[model samples]
Target chain A: MNTDPTRLSAAELAHAIASKELSSVEVVQAHLDRIAAVDADVHAFLHVDGAGALDAARAVDERRASGEDLHVLAGVPIAVKDVMATKGLPTTCGSKILEGWIPPYDATLVSRLKAAGMPILGKTNMDEFAMGSSTEHSAYGPTHNPWDLTRIPGGSGGGSSAVVAAYEAPLAIGTDTGGSIRQPASVTGTVGVKPTYGGVSRYGLVALASSLDQAGPCTRTVLDAALLHSVIGGHDPMDSTSINAPVPSVVEAARRADVKGLKVGVIKELGGEGYQAGVRARFDESVTLLQEAGAEVVEVSCPSFDYALAAYYLILPSEASSNLAKFDAMRYGLRVLPEGIEDPSAEQVMAATRDAGFGDEVKRRIILGTYALSSGYYDAYYGQAQKVRRLIANDFSTAFEQVDVLVSPTAPTTAFKLGDKLDDPMSMYLQDVATIPANLAGVPGMSLPSGLADEDGLPTGIQILAPATQDERLYNVGAALEKMLVDRWGGPLLAKAPQLTAKGA
Target chain B: MPPEHARGRFVVREAPRLAPMSALSRDDVAHLAGLARIDLSDAELDRMVGELGVILESVAKVQEVAADEIEPMSHPLPLTNVTRPDEVRPSLGAEAALAAAPEKEQQRFSVPRILDED
Candidate 1:
């Protein structure tokens, strides 16, 4: 009961909850209070089910009282990004189109989390249908950066990043489509991982560029991600693309983290042009740290990384438009016809539904996707984009041949004000520069907290990328760097995070 | 930069510029929208036509460097045969499947008839 509530790490909280130093109900209540207090300004969550969360917490408490053996993450509070469906929870994907729709089933990842005994806090916000790089595209609203209330948190996982950064929750799950998780983590100074493409089951995740989407853990510490990721990742029969493989040994990799003798390739093209000086400085510093840790640092150029964004825009939007077609008002989603009309034409209802349901960014992509898929343009646009996708994958494979892993500043800059880049979607899309390649190549990528942006003093992140299916490499390198950085900084990156005590911490 | 990199996908070559279809006019955007079955107003079409051009221009960078000698990689990982074998398994039948349809009669979903579609 006396566990210091606000600042505890997920690992610490899990131990406390299991040892009875804290009650699951108390843990959920504290997070709920935090969300209630700080989230109004941060807008991290589109919907917070305080009552539902409390009920789940009480269930965990009862199980423990009955002397039931529990899972490792038992009673720990977790937030699900709105992009994933949770049974009975409003899984809106941060869109007004499906505002009050409750899902009938949980995503496979969510089911795994609940099975692990983690308490579901609520659904956090995300870009509308996970289409935007910034959460600004979310029809409900953009999530504010927790470090600075006025700045934008990265997206479409921005809401999840903000919730963990703001201490509204110690851990949350997020999906990454072209850097959604890592980019947000860069801006929020949290740990975000996008596992290998088929690492986690996508059965219940709202489809957003299915080929590019993969869900992973976002937390304040590397070990925390390892813990959560282990529980949710593995082969699933429900997803045809799910890898029929054992979960990578992330937890052990974290514990045995050592960068000595490893080769780290600094992608020559990632940092030089279009990146902020502050971000580059921190990236250079990270490379130096890696070298000092006995790892050989070298520059490996993945020129294909330069064209990745162009390839992604073509591929992702094309996929998004097709996927989102399921949300037609004729479906189980919103149906808004004329003010008063029975048996309105399905065409009119669908037109009205998409117009109201989708935001400008989403609509823009859908149109572009439609154009690309059009018979007249498909061979040139979609065909070329798919070819370029192959080129990018080749570039990653070639680069890994020279280096054990690649590193870069997770994003070009730190957190920006919410509205800063919204006006120009191109600039917003460019923000995923460091993150897109891994997703494009179907490999693994993770962002570890680095130093703060000199200008805004908000946290920045450094990314570590690995070859496909070698997700354990990311944890091995990431955990080593995180532990070293924490030791140098005298604690975890969030140690200096502004403490916002709930009504009664 | 390395040549013929491992797990190679698209190849990038320097082009004086990435070229997109200049064929798209304002009317083209409107026509494309209709074909896609999404409704867009004139004002929306006006903006979309221009935005689509730039997006096309930006993404056309892919076309600049890829050589005809290179084969495109559709997926990053070299994975194949991601299918489950057919087996007798329980499934939610037609009643449960169409349970949420807005209009239903005699175990069938009723909707305003449209041309063949999903």
Candidate 2:
């Protein structure tokens, strides 16, 4: 057995367990120890299900002993972003309102993970209700970047990103609504994919923006992400928006890792201007590498992309305002009675609870959404944003006509300092400018670590987008680029992350 | 460890302004807050008026591209009228459903009274 079982990727760990060379219990224990050693500083997990994970690992070992057929990813452990519900496990979604709320039912994806015999380590932290670019919006506190502890792990899935980067878990789940998944992956030097809208089930996911939210794998390798994607992606009768078609051949594509004859379109509008010098340099080098690898690279202009950020904020807030209306202090979650008032009305309690529970970013968006959806302003704001959404989708359809996949720098820059954009909401919103177009168009997008930016010595990620339902193309290009970058650096980008030792030990 | 302890560890960091503030009035913000059912103090409202004003001005660009011919799409997929047969299945039982309720009585969610006795 390897000295450190936690260091292996999910794919490798699965192979080891399948081969009988290593036990699932050992791997799970190693990860728990790693979490104990470092999570105090990283704070990736809101709750670590050490006992549950080990029990599941033992169950998998028994299944193997019985010679029963097991899933490919059986015995591998994963960290779930807290946004997804796990039956009997606390699913907080990084908000004080839902703190300590142990969901009675599992999200379809979580059930799938359990059925596949994947032990869930715990629920990871996230931006409060998945509302911010940096996890600082989390009511629990921010998840620091593993590369540089002073910096943020890109959010709202910062916890997932941090765990993968820090080697606490080999795989994780992250939902992207306006770049929650990809942006975090970019900044953390990991891999994250936002599967095609409706490509993955959203039944158990806590909704932020119904139209834009799609969960996918967060992993250290493109192949591992593809493997996890195969495990989780499928048609579900429970989710009306779920695609009835079969999950794309993402695993096969990742294994191929060949971009020969692929038309990779560099999005004309997604780069330059506000882009950091180091991010652009890394992105440019990756593009050149793709061209040299026999892929046909072209520049495709998606004009409506310019309005993507504007349309996304308006649409997201509008939907969020309506979706979040469920937390009314009635059925579930935190209920705060109005202070200094006897027999306060339910409405008064709800107002007070929300006022105390939700953080600034969540409040800001809710207000923006309420105003957008207001009766008088609906046509000019929410309605117009929906129209712009259509145009963005149209632009994607046209761009796909000339290209197999679109490429861009995942986020405008690498991970900024923890407090860099806290006061400025607009600057924080700009971080998702490159990744938002994919969610807007309902396309699949992947962010793979390109290289470390020269200026800040932080990781930069290259985003690959495929037309809706052709999600496999993202894996093909992503894997191809990941392999080339690994070869160039002589190791994975995450191998360069500064080790997190026990603080004050 | 109380949950609020986790919050208190990080100092509140404010963002630098990136967009020009527009004309969203304080009253407008208060009305939106009321509609959203989020009770905001006067200081928060004052800050929101400026923050939301800038956000609205930035997102107002959506109007520039809103053409009359372009139909608004509420979802990405074109399929509509998705329905399931109306058959009851086992679901969260009363105990499970009421378990997370902040206040419960008689297997029902208990809330503050709304009506005045006539």
Candidate 3:
């Protein structure tokens, strides 16, 4: 195996597998090798299904050899977040409670990815219960940003983005409860999209805040992202809330690369405060490039954005606290008996199970959630937050009235060093401030790398937000910016990544 | 850790302790933890008290708007009947499901004895 592995892109990988130029086995082996060599240092994958992935890849190769028709994603390797349940693949949600528990069934999205013939690359690390913006809260160790090990990769989808950026996989799936996908993509210099809330089914995805959670595609290129989005974005009878609207042709939009006559709204809030200088410079330059490409840019303001973080905290934890209630010792997950209490009472057993299984951050959120949803405070807190959530949604609705789409810096800065702020949960929560509004509003948002952070010299991104059903606008604009940036930068961001000492590639 | 003096309407309202804040004093958090069936070390409880206080304060901004007339919006998107039909669907059979359980007696998953005599 070459120390500097030059693997195929999504299209190339798919074509090679289909045409028999590259057997699925070889493609799967390359990635498994990549994981073995460097993933120890990157810590991107929570679990690597070496044998299972190869066996599945081999099945794809055999089918193609038998002259069977190929699925668009046949033989592709996609990493799943640990938050998404996969049959028998320790879906721990980065917490010790679910550490050794292997879910008996696959999540809805997992089944979709599997049916598409994508080899499950294994579960990637994420924030415990998708609660934190950085994966540091993972009961497992944090995933280091591929750009610089010292910096974080962004979370809770940081591990997913890192695998793609590090070339351990060509495409991955991430859940964007509140910018989990987009924020990490910004820092890691990859493509991440949070489809309209109903665009992707959430049946199997471990819930953080159901209203805010939606799984989207993360890939190295816009076309690739669009392709994966099309496959995973659709209605499901299982999830009645899934939109019945037809999934628009995002791949065609990427292929068209036509930005003419599109009105892109520049959200005034996300531009300056806490934005790194390089990020702003790049964002401005990209806007100019889009303007030059025949797209009109307009300044749009959403004042409710200032309060989005507050609303998100209340809603997410309240929802999470409830959603996670199923993991009692009575159901699945850890069940412990107290140390000294012989034949402990049920209450003691419950306390022991919880004390041993739950982590600090998880406990903290549950407490906060219980308090928010508690009776006397319900109207003042939970009820009020829901009202504010509506106001935030109203802000988006109003903004979309004047413009086709909205744009802003995806994150304040590029990926920070792992452990830089792990001890500080408040600082960690603040990282998702820029990306959470869309989740509250149920809007579709995509993040594509704009420029390197001048301060840290790592990738940062700008987010594209479009109206609920009008997700096509994101593709129209994202593809345009992606094409422009790649042409200037010479290639994808991961192309410049140096070989790692551990995972050679 | 959060500032003790940082207590505000936002903090108190958003993450109010269990009980009326009167039912349990320093033990509200502990009792809440117990109710939720999650164990909390002294350090974790201490941290949560301070964190919850500050968060509740920050979340106070939600009340600034006049919501007396506003209806609670459960979802951002408009909703009608979002629930699926209660139609019969194929489910796993006993053999398929019990085949993988860590420990199973008969058809049901047999976990360790969880309850003590009430």
Candidate 4:
């Protein structure tokens, strides 16, 4: 009890609350206080539900006092990405159009988290409509990286990863369309999982790319992510696309933390040349660590991965254009009238509202997507991208036959400076090169801190991908590598991050 | 546009650069905006044409390998048509459904006039 409970992992906090070493209220308050102290500098949360969180925490304490059996991670507090719908809390998806919209019903994952007795802390910031890599495109403002305020935390789930990295929250939910969760986790030195595409229910998740968006865990420790994953990853009748099978035993796999005799494949196409030198160095070191841990490491190539990023851009924007069509002014969210028009038509209003609401990136994507899905271009753009998608999935199917899991650098480099690649869309898209293939193929991927890069002293992440439904393998390998890295570094990677001081605190 | 300019700032070593596709034009962008129901200013259209041109040129690499024999994959799951029993269930009330509407009239979303008729 003497230690700051905010710094403890979710598992540790749950143990403390269950054993009466601390009340849920105390633990929740500690996190709330931490959020208040550091959030000014971090800007991770779009909204902090202090009162609602306290009430939920108190309910957990009451349940414990009444001797009612609770879920394993009960009383643990979590931050949710704004992309997921929250019943009472404002869910903006980082766009001005839905700035004040409060969803009337909870996302299935949010409902699951609440049922597990995890207090909903608040909605964290993200890129507009979960679109950008650096969270700079968020209509509200950019979320500053805690490691270096000038740098990005990575996005569109930057706030979720940043909250965990800044120790303001033990767990957060992030949706990964194209490495939104994993890349942010990579840059911020946290753990993120993009569950097998259909592994987690997508009900209530604001769609960016319907076929690609899968909400998953963002946490500081591999075990915590596993626990949160267990809570949120189950079949839901509400989501037709949800996997009907039982959630993979990722928690047990994380607990096992053994990869001895496992076949680990290094994707030949994912690395070399384009990767930053320091990132490559760290990845190579992690491979050696895995080899020493008794994993049989071999090189496996996915030749079709060459077209992955290209296919992804086409597929994502095409789906996003259709999915985002729901935001027409006739429905919920923003609506604006064209100026100087005494009688603004509905079409004009919709156009004016969209023009005012969407950022440059969102507009760019929508336009590109519309063009891709348009009559003449449909066969050439969207159709071709889908075919490439099949090839990418085929490559994964082939790779899994030779190896149990595949590993690569999570991203091409560590977090670049905010605004560095903002002007260049292609440069920004390249940041997600390694992580995109998994989403394209619907495979589960986890990114954990490898170590800090020598050049910038920024954290580099090693990504582990398991074939669809083999998600447990990722947890097993990730936990094993995490344990080894922690032992070598003498602590977790986030321990080395420069502490954030509240401005004028 | 040259191949390098079309690829923009980032270079993908593995992706074989294909012939640059038609450069996206302002009129094309405006037409796309109209289709998507997004109003864009002249500057936005100008900027977007250039940006989309680069993106389109780069993404055209997908056509290099996406042969006709390969089938398209729209969804990862094999789930075909997931239909539940048609029995009606409780859903959001009218007030709740329209809670976030920018303009509402008596629990229904009010919108700008569409038809010319009264």
Candidate 5:
């Protein structure tokens, strides 16, 4: 058995616990210790529930001792993005507005994680309301890339990806609305998936863009993602939009890991021009490797994808504006009285609270959404964006007809320095160009490390997109590509990252 | 090739070739912020005017191919009117529900004055 339980994959740790080789308490404690040692520099977690995790781990050990049948992932520890509601845990959604607001009920996915007996480590950091491409928007703080401490891990789900890459947790849950999950995974050299839009229940996921938001897995390996996915996915009575179908056989597909005779499409629109040269090189090499493995590779065009970013900006702001309207200093969350007012009216108080609570980016989107949905501009902006959404979806349908799956570089570049694009919102928005189309179309997407970029020696990721409801295909191809890449590098890409010890040690 | 619906259609609003980049003004942003119930500081309003202009200019590209014949898609799924059998079930107790509220009184959410004193 591995001496350091922190280094073991969630699958291996689960196996060891099930076989009574390593107790669940030891596994959970090793992760808690890892979080203690390295999380200072990584800033991957907003809170670490050490006591709660130990209690859960102890219960699992007792259950195993009593010869109780347990779920496959039972006893394995997991981290969750702060965006999802956790019954008794703070779910701030990286915003000051909801700071210290503990949910009354667990999100459907959180309930599933608890039911599977996975010990919850705590809430990870994120962009405020999952709005930005960089986690710098987080009111708490940005999560730094484990590879290069000065660089971004990726936004919205940066903390989840960082935790997995830094070995703070073997598995984490991340929600993707316009590439939150996959983009972070790309920059961090970890695996992240955005399942089909309705594939996972969104009952207690604080709504960002109701149409685009979907929670999926963040993990060190493809199989671990599949394992976590099956546990959290499936229909829920609480989420009316959740797909009423069994989760695809992702575990079986992951183990199959054979891409022979598979038709792979390299998206014509997603590469060249804006893409970093090193990113393109890694993607091309990955495609060649796939061809060498007997998979047929072809270039397919989804021209309508050219407008996907534009449509997303409009649609997301429109929905987010409405979704965020609930934080009006009324029912819950932070409340502030208007300055210089003896008796502030409800409207005045709401405005004051919002101004004090929301960060610049959140306010920007809310204002944009408000304008988009306003009287005369509604048809010109929101309605037109909706039409474009259909066009993008149609493009996916057309492309999927020619190929089994579409592929691209997950993000346009490797991790940039923390403050590089902070001032320029448009430049930051361009980072999600390749990953957003999958979310807009509601198809599943997976991002796995392709290779390190030659120029910067930073990790680059290859993204795989499958048709809606055919999520298993992503795992199948992702696992196959990951295996090939690992064999070439002689280990996982994360092995190349700079090692971190306890801060000030 | 354009999709069937988008091809050869006379649209009510012809897609603008190049929407003016500086179309949004500081006053417009302030108005929008007011509508959203956010009291933006003058500094924030100034910065947002520039930032949001760029974003709006870029996102305006969505109007390019939004032909009249194309249908608007609100959601990825085709689900509509999803319902379950009506039955009383366990729910959050009043205390639990009001636990996180900023102000609560008499088992209900308390708020600032909504009407002027008569």
Candidate 6:
């Protein structure tokens, strides 16, 4: 057996623990040690709950020793994005407003993870309120890309992807509103999936854009994501938007790993012009590989996709404005008194506290949202964006009629320098262009490492989009492509990544 | 009442026309920040004016095709009101509910004065 547990996938770790060849405590401790060794440089985690994780691992070991059946992913340690509410663990959403605040209850998904006996490593960092493209927006500071220390590991789920890429955790949970999961996964050379909207319960996920937010698995391999997804994806009456139907058989589809006779569409609008040369080359190579693997490939055009980024900005800020209004000084977060006021009013306190607590990006969006949803502008901005939303959904429906799944480069380019786009919001918004269309249309999308770019030698991801409720197709196609790509590279793409040396060594 | 298909749907009677968009001014941004209950500093306000102007100009493109007879999608899935039996169930107690409150008094969240003294 491999002595280093961090190098193993979550599936491998689970098998080792279940067979009694390794104890859950040992596996969890190994990851904790790995975190201690590399995380100072990586900065992937906002908090590391080492004691709680070890206790949970012990419980799993005891249950297994008593000959009790366990979930497939039981005993595996995982990191969670800070946006999910985990009781007793501080969840900051990478913003100072909620700093030091511990959630009173676990999110439904977190509760599910517990029920399945998975030990949570801790909360990972993200962009403030999941707002920016680079993790640089995190109030705690940015997570460096493990591939290249100076570059970003895409946002806002940068921490989740970085942990997996750096081998700090086998699996992690990430929320995607507009490419938060996939974009980071693309840049970090990992696998990320955004389950069909309503597929995963949103019950304790701090709302970003409610309509677009969906929590899913981030892992190093497609099958590992599948295993984690099945545990967390299901109907939750607590979330009204949760689908009443059973989860798609993603695990089964991933194991099948068959793409024969499947129809794959290369979205016409998602590539060209703004895309990097290496990204396009890698995407084209993946398409050819899919065709050779017995999947029929065709070019499908969705013209409304050109407006996806525009509509997303309007729709997100509008929804976010309403959702974030609850962060007034009175409850559950920071409070500040107006300067030079003897008896400040509630409104004044709220204004001052919000100004002090929120970072610039969060403030920017809230004000933008307030402006969009305001009278006179609502009809032109928010309403118009909602209409464009329908057009994008229609485009998906039209494209789905021609093919089983849509494919594209997950991001326009590989991860840029950490502070390169920090001051420019528009350029940062462009990172999510390809991934946003899936969220708008209520579809499931997966991003898997296609290959390292020829120019920068950084990872590039090929996105696979399946129509709503047909999320299994994404796994089937994704696993097949992942296998072919890995065989060509002679190993996982992460293996090609430069290794990180211990901080003090 | 309109038919099921027409309900909650917006119909544009006129041909789709682009809405005129003017760049957001500093005063406009300041007003927006006020509406949002965030007291932006003068420097922040100055920077936001230029940033918001660029973002607003880009997002305004949505108005181009929006004049068509398209129903606005507020949510991805068609969700009806989800309800359960009107029965008592275990929920968070007051102790736990107020656990995260910035300030609390007598098991209730404390807030700054909402009304002026008479």
Using all chains and alpha carbons, the TM-scores for the candidates as numbered come to 0.93, 0.96, 0.92, 0.96, 0.97, 0.97
Residue-level lDDT of model 6, residues A216-309, one tens digit each, is: 9999999999999999999999999999999999999999998899899999999899999999999999999999999999999888888889
RMSD of each: 3.6, 7.6, 4.5, 3.6, 2.4, 3.8
Each candidate's interface RMSD? 3.7, 8.1, 4.6, 4.4, 2.3, 4.1
Provide the interface RMSD of candidate 3 in angstroms, 1 decimal place: 4.6
- What is candidate 2's lDDT per residue for A1-505, written digit by digit as tens? 3468888989999999999888899889989999998999999999999999999999999999899999999999999999999999999999999988999999999999999999999989999999988899999989989999899999999999999999999999999999999999999999999999999999999999999999999999999999999989999988999999899999999999899898999998888899999999999999999999999999998878888899999999999999999999999999998889987877889899999888999999999999888887788888988988888888889889999999999999989999999999999999999999888879999999989988889999999999999999999989998889899999888878888886432
Q: Write the residue-wise lDDT of candidate 6 on B1-118 in tens digits.
A: 2222221123323323333345577888889899999999999999988888788888876755634477889889997999999999999999999988989999899999998878
Is candidate 5 or 6 superior in TM-score? 5
Q: Write out the backbone clash pairs for model 5.
A: none
lDDT of 5 by residue, A1-505 (tens): 5689998898999899999999989999999988989999999999899999999999999999999999999999999999999988999999999998999999999999999999999999999999987799999989999999999999889999999999999999999999999999999999999999999999999999999999999999999999999999999989999999999999999999999999999998998899889889999999999899989999998878888899999999999999999999888899999889999899999999999999989999999899889887888889988888888898899889999999999999999999999999999999999988888889999999998999999999999999999999999999999999999999989889889877542
Task: Give the Å shift of residue B67 in candidate 5.
Answer: 1.7
Candidate 4 local lDDT, A240-294, one digit each (tens): 8899899999999999999999999999989798899989999999999999999
> Per candidate, chain B TM-score?
0.68, 0.75, 0.60, 0.75, 0.80, 0.77
Of the two candidates 1 and 2, the one with more favorable TM-score, higher being better, is: 2
- Whose TM-score is greatest here? 5
Candidate-wise lDDT, in order: 0.83, 0.90, 0.82, 0.91, 0.92, 0.92
In candidate 6, which residue pairs get closer than 3 Å at backbone N, Cα or C atoms, i.e. clash? none
Please provide, for model 3 over A56-175, each residue's C-alpha lDDT reduced to its tens digit, 9 standing for 90 to 100.
Answer: 898888888888887888998889988888987888999888878777788888888888888888889888888777788888989988888877889989899989988889899999
Q: Model 1, range A198-262, lDDT digits (tens) per residue? A: 99999999998989899999999889999999999999989888888899999999888899999
Query: B1-118 in candidate 4: lDDT tens per residue?
Result: 2233222112223334343456566788898899899999998987887888889998988866625677898877676788888898999999898888888997688888887756
User: Per-candidate DockQ versus the true complex?
Assistant: 0.38, 0.35, 0.34, 0.49, 0.62, 0.50
Relative to the unseen true structure, what is the C-alpha lDDT of residue B35 in candidate 4, on a scale of 0 to 100?
88
**Between which residue pairs do clashes occur in model 4?**
none
Q: Please state the error at residue A131 of candidate 2 in Å.
A: 0.4
lDDT of 2 by residue, B1-118 (tens): 1122111112112222223346578988898898899999999998988888778888987765525678998888887677888999889899999999998998899998876535
TM-score of chain A of each: 0.96, 0.99, 0.97, 0.99, 0.99, 0.99
Please tell me what DockQ candidate 3 reaches: 0.34
lDDT of 1 by residue, B1-118 (tens): 3244232344434543323466578887777676555678778888888777777777776666655666766665565766667788886578655545556778876665455354
